[model samples]
Target: MQWITIFKKEILEDWRNYKWIWVPLVFIVICIMDPISTYYLPQILESVGGMPEGTVLEPPEVVPSQAIMMSLTELSMLGVLVIVAISMSVIAGERKSGVAELILVKPVSYFTYISAKWAEKLLLVFTSYLIGMLASWYYVDLLFGQITAGQFFSLFFFYLIWLIFVISLTIFYNTIVKVPGLVLTLTVVTIMAMSAINQIFSYRMPWFPNSISGHITKMLMENSVPNALWGAVSITIILSVGLLIASNFILKTKEMAD
Candidate 1:
């Protein structure tokens, strides 16, 4: 019951602060841009009006999978920053402002409080992903090619796991470091480093959780996912669970800086 109350409070914060509005709008725009740009490259180039006379422009055919890939890539690049910005203040802001101190003096357990925050943020991420996915599929089919249900679900679930891992990491980092700016910087740097290391050791450590993007690209290209993805998924799930538990523990020791 207390957890639910705290979760609702988190949701209310999202609503009042307009985080729910702008975040999903950004995602929807990214989704729409993916297919629109792919299908209209020739026209877009012509509109630039710098082409030599009689230059033939043959636009490349864009596939549905390609649009999906572009959408997911945009999310990976831009969405992480957006999500981190919104989540950076979850605990740090409260602690810094003495809100955590006031609230902690009540009957609230730190575990329930942190769990509620994590759960609510997870739900928000899932909602945004759904909207982005549906919008991408609708436009991709209209502008590029038909996306079958099988293609959509296979890649979506696989990509979703990676996204969940990222959100968990953001929260875990938020709890560990109270400075919002440092939290954002460290989280982005860590994820980028993980991706690079995963690539450098691709053949050697195919089962590592950071190889998620490679698997996502392969699935988007309509290829059979390598058996290594299963291993990565397992590792990612364990890590995400550990992050939440660690966050819960860390939150208990926080003293309000204000």
Candidate 2:
């Protein structure tokens, strides 16, 4: 009941702020743009700058899986930045407005307050992703070729798990930092830095959430998931729980308004 109450409040706030609408629209554009643009890339290149005479305008073949994967990569780089930028103020904004203090004065636990943020944002992230991805999948089939349902869903399912880690980590960072700009920078830097580190030692830490993007690409190109991928899922789950606890602790001790 407590979580439901907080979840409703979070949703209403997002609605009022237009996050519920614009965030999904951003993802949909990113997803659909990939296939549509790739399908017309040759035309686009030709129109922008004329190709040399006698040059064969043969574009490389676009595979359905690869097209979808590219759409997700857009999500990873630009999409993560957009989503984090929009949701960066979840905790930080509340604290600045003194809403956090007002809520804490009542019979609310920090765990519930924090979990509500985590859950609502997670829902926002995943729901937008799924819709965008499904649209991408359809257009990929239309523009390129069809991938087996098994292959497409496998790629999507695993990628979604990693996205959960992204949203959760951002929420966790927001709890610790009060400045939205600093929070945004730190969250992006930390996650991107971790991804870069994992890339350096990929063989040893294939299960890292950052690695999931590459793994999904791998799955698209190859039919099988690498054995180490499950480890990444397990690690992400454990890390998500740890982040929730850390955020809860911070909200209780240091989440005061300035």
Candidate 3:
């Protein structure tokens, strides 16, 4: 019940801060741009006419699935930065501003406090992403080709787990680090390190969370998903939950010290 109360408060704060507006707007622009640009690329190149007079430029046929995937890939970079920027401050900023102290001194458990924050952020990010994906899908279907509902849902489910991992990692650092800048740096470094490690050891460890992107691509381009993907999904879920628990534990420890 307290979580619901805090969740509502968080949502109101986000709206007042313009996060609800700008975050989703950014995602929509990022996603839809991919499909629209890809669709008009050939015509735009022809209009330029800078190529050799004798050369005819032939753009490869772009498929709907590939176009959608490309948009998702772009999100993993720019959109993820947006996520990090917004989430880095969820705990650290609150703690620095005395907001956390004000709230925690009340009847709220630290776990309840963290849960409410986590749930609110999760809803915001996931809703923004879903809206973006749907917008991109509309263009991809109109310009490229029709994408099956099954394919759309599959991609959605896989990417959701990946996002869970990302948000959890950022929130974990936010709880432990007092400075938002340091939390951002640490979160980015940890993500990059994990991604690099997954790249290096993908053969031996297909269950890494970073491997989810590859699995998504495989499912799209190859029309099949590896059985080992379930292992990756399970591990990702476990790690996400572990990180949230760790965040709550660390926050409690820090509170007791203070």
Per-residue CA lDDT of candidate 3, range 62-98, in tens?
A: 8888889888888888888788888899889988878
Candidate 3, residue 172: Cα displacement in angstroms equals 0.3
Q: After superposition, how far is residue 240 of candidate 2 from its true place, in Å?
A: 1.1
In model 1, what is the error at residue 32, expressed in angstroms? 2.5
Per-residue alpha-carbon lDDT of model 2 for 1-258, expressed as tens digits?
898999999999889989889888889898889788888888888888868887767656977878888888888888888878876888887787787788877898889988888889988888888888888888888888897889878887887787777777888888888778878898899888997898899888777778887877777777888766777778888898888898888777883755
List residue ranges in candidate 1 displaced over 4 A: 222-224
Better of 1 and 2 by lDDT: 2
Worst 10 residues of 1 by lDDT: 249-258
Q: Evaluate model 2: give its TM-score.
A: 0.94
Each prediction's whole-model lDDT (CA): 0.82, 0.83, 0.87
Each candidate: how many clashes? 0, 1, 0
Which candidate number maximizes lDDT?
Answer: 3
Regions of model 3 farther than 4 Å from truth: 256-258
